[model samples]
Target: MKILVCISKVPDTTAKIAFKDNNTSYDTNGVQFIINPYDEWYALVRALEIKESQGGSVTVINVGGAENDPTIRKALAIGADDAVRVNTLASDALNTAQNIADYAKKEGFDMVFCGKETIDYNGSQVGGMIAALMDMPYISYASKMNIVESKATIERDIQGGKEVLEVEVPFVLSAAKGMAEARIPNMRGIMAARTKPLNVIEPSNTDYMTEIVGYELPPAKGECRFVDAENPEELIELLRNEAKII
Candidate 1:
């Protein structure tokens, strides 16, 4: 089995987000970036587990410039056999998916894995777009998957329940939580990652379909108001008038 895991670099969850350039772009200065949690904790780990059990290779791919190499190295330390960095700015989900799909088509990977969404953008569209570009089946929000002799059994989350599916090889999956346990890179893996291959390729000529105009933070939260427990009528009045929920 040849598995391709798509990874992304995102601002650390606790990083203070800010906009720059007249609020048209993110202020990346002094920001610490890491592999997206969903990509690292579930998608990449699940692909590694599949490779370990099935005796195949797991390759990690990222769509970004050289600055993302550190994040790519972390994926390698987590057990990807090799890495591929598409030399381009991840302008939008569609272009990123196109770059990945272009490479995956040439490589002819049996399975592809990606997080359901990126933390920064929260656009759950790349995996499906890749699947469409590759003309393969796509399973989204996959929580569990098992492969046996060219067939794959998958369990995915739905509204208030889950669905079980079966598909042949050569498919794409957007992994969600419960796919696999997170793995921390040990000293040995870190050292081994230093020697792992990190290949860089220029992206094919593709134009971004969308552009960011501006960004604004949400309004500040209002201060809390206290209501006396003995004043039930007052509380009801407050709910009806101030809180407005009735």
Candidate 2:
């Protein structure tokens, strides 16, 4: 099983977020970056688990600039055999997915894994886009996957229950929680990662279907409203009319 796992670099969850240039760009100053947790904890770790059990190599791929190299290296330390960095700064989902598909197309990987969404953007767009561009089957929010020979059994959470599926090789899946437990790099693994191969390549396409207009922060918290507990009708009305939950 030759597996390809997509990696993403994102700000630490505890980092302070701010916008710059009149709220058009994200501020990087004083920000700490890390491997997107969904990618690291679930997708990448699951891929490594497969490799350990099935006897094949795992390759980690990312589409970003030099700053992302360290993030990719962390994946290597976790247990990937090699890494590929598409040396491009693509904030657009279409372009980023396109870049990954362009490389995976040439690599002939049997399985492609991705986190359900990045922590920063939470777009949940790239995995599906890559599957579409590659003309491959896509399974989103997969929480469990088992491989035997050339067949794969997968499970995903749906509205009320879990959905199970069977697929062959050469498919894409977005990993969710419960895929695998997170693994921290040991000292030996960390030392080996320094010498592991990390190939950098340029993107095949640079054009993007969309671009960011600008970013605006959400509105500040509104004042609290009190509803008379004596009247359930009033509480229902407040929830429906004000909170809009129903």
| Predictions in order: lDDT | 0.94, 0.92
TM-score of each: 0.95, 0.90
TM-score of 1: 0.95
- Candidate 1, 141-230: lDDT as tens digits: 999999997999999998999999999989999999999999999999999999999999999847999887899999998888887888
Candidate 1 lDDT score at position 104:
95
Q: What residue runs in model 2 are displaced by over 4 Å at the alpha carbon?
A: 222-246
lDDT of 2 by residue, 1-246 (tens): 999999899999999888999888999999989998988999999999998998998999999999888888999999999999999986999999999999999989999999999999999999999999999999999999999999999998777889999998889999999999999999988899999999999899899888788898889888877777787798888788878997
The 10 consecutive residues of candidate 2 with the worst lDDT sum are 223-232
Q: By TM-score, who's the top model here?
A: 1
